[model samples]
Target: MAHYFVGDIQGCFAELQKLLLKVDFNPSKDTLWAVGDLVARGPDSLATLRFFQSLGDTGKVVLGNHDMHLLALHGKLKRNKPSDNLTPLLNAPDIESLISWLRLQPLMRELPEHNVIMTHAGVPPQWSLETLRQESQLVSQALQQADYLDALISKMYSDTAERWEPNAIGINRLRFCINALTRMRYLFVDGHLDFDCKQPPENCTNPQLRPWFDFASPLRESHTLVFGHWAALMGKVNSPKLKALDTGCCWGEYLTLWHLESDQKITQKRLKKS
Candidate 1:
């Protein structure tokens, strides 16, 4: 009867198992919310994906940058950056099926009771929950259709505008998908997406850009939204309403999960550097 939200799992299946055990997670009764990046970088990417896919019932996930990249890269549609440490993943024998299921996952989830909008990077401050859900569905529909991944892979890098007009398509729709599913971090004072900034908010010098949750009213006043893209922000930001769960599990840090109703904390086993 409990709902749990977990941060970026990366490929840390062992840590995920330990954390689930610690929480006494019952698959039949409890729900697990994953903030994506389910595979890549860490060990046992195959195991992690298979384990969750077996959960099969109602494990909700939103695609993160790495997760999307894994799909595109595995499908041979896109090449990762030189800095990406995905050799272990590329070499895994079961990589094909692992990616197929990953690509089938949705890009956003809405919690009815808490009114929590769940996504990997979260909705931009300019977008309301309804607008965000509809747009995400647009992308999801295209993704689920046949030959859509091929289209998405072919036109992955064009449009970058902040506002959406009526029924935009092709690369424009792809841009919405990418922004919602992948590269989101900062929003401009005018509610535009600012993809340039990377430093933590405290160290950030750009006064024009703010986090997505700093918008005017209702969105700010509405129920809390949960997300996990910015590993640098870490977990338990203490915003009272907003919850950030990524604890940098892939980078020798701890994996974190949170309970929606009780505001409780759960931690997975951490890895030690050799």
Candidate 2:
């Protein structure tokens, strides 16, 4: 069975299907993994969510910032914006089941057999893999519990905590973890998360900032880290251990699909307007 890791789908269902067809993907014999942002921005969010939900065990996804935003909208913690392109999904009869399935997905997923770990964003330099796993589980547990889900979603929207604190508790802790796992891109030299910059590393003019993967983390040495949140990256990073898969298919660019074992990259361009 082959493992295919795809970039942020972001409701680009037509492109995703085309990519799968390029690989002749068979769900019965192949596993599909996504770095998240499963819905939003592109057309057909409802169809995209339903398709992934139907994949069941063969498909795996981590939550992205968009996915969390979707949850917050569902829980009435946030209002939906028209630009999100999610109204169809929100009005779907199976919305509850789809959201529930999404909530149950972890923020970080580890594949020990492949010595790989994936999150929506890249790993933080300060976090050991074990700490990352534990913190991610904390958020996942809260999200899975109906009683605490709304409260957790309500507090998840801030960027105030830039650095990690071992003693951080309650909402502060959950917010920090969520930001690090799903929204992180750059870090200040001292290892604090930077929220403002989204430019490619070469174009970044800020001296204090560096891409998260540029930091010296044990995670880089221990496992192949795959992530997809930064579409501006256009699937490029310096290190062999780090893979940036988001190719901005929703932005009229191409979709990227990585064949994990062979390290082969397959891409499909966005469909042209008829």
lDDT of 2 by residue, 1-274 (tens): 9999999999999999999999999999999999989999999888888998899999988999999999988887788889989999999999999988898888989889999998999889888989999999999989988775557887777889778999999888988999998999999999899999999998999999999998888888889999999999998889888889999999999999999989999999998866
TM-score of each: 0.90, 0.98
* Per-residue lDDT of model 1, residues 201-236, tens digit only: 887899898876666646657867788888888763
- Name model 1 segments beyond 4 Å from true: 80-94, 236-238
* CA-lDDT, candidates in order: 0.76, 0.91
Q: What CA root-mean-square deviation does each model show from the true structure?
A: 2.3, 1.0
Can you list the residue pairs that collide in candidate 1? none
Q: Which regions of candidate 2 deviate over 4 angstroms?
A: none
Model 2 — which ten-residue stretch has the worst lDDT?
Answer: 146-155
lDDT of 2: 0.91
lDDT measured at residue 265 in model 2 versus the true structure, 0 to 100: 94
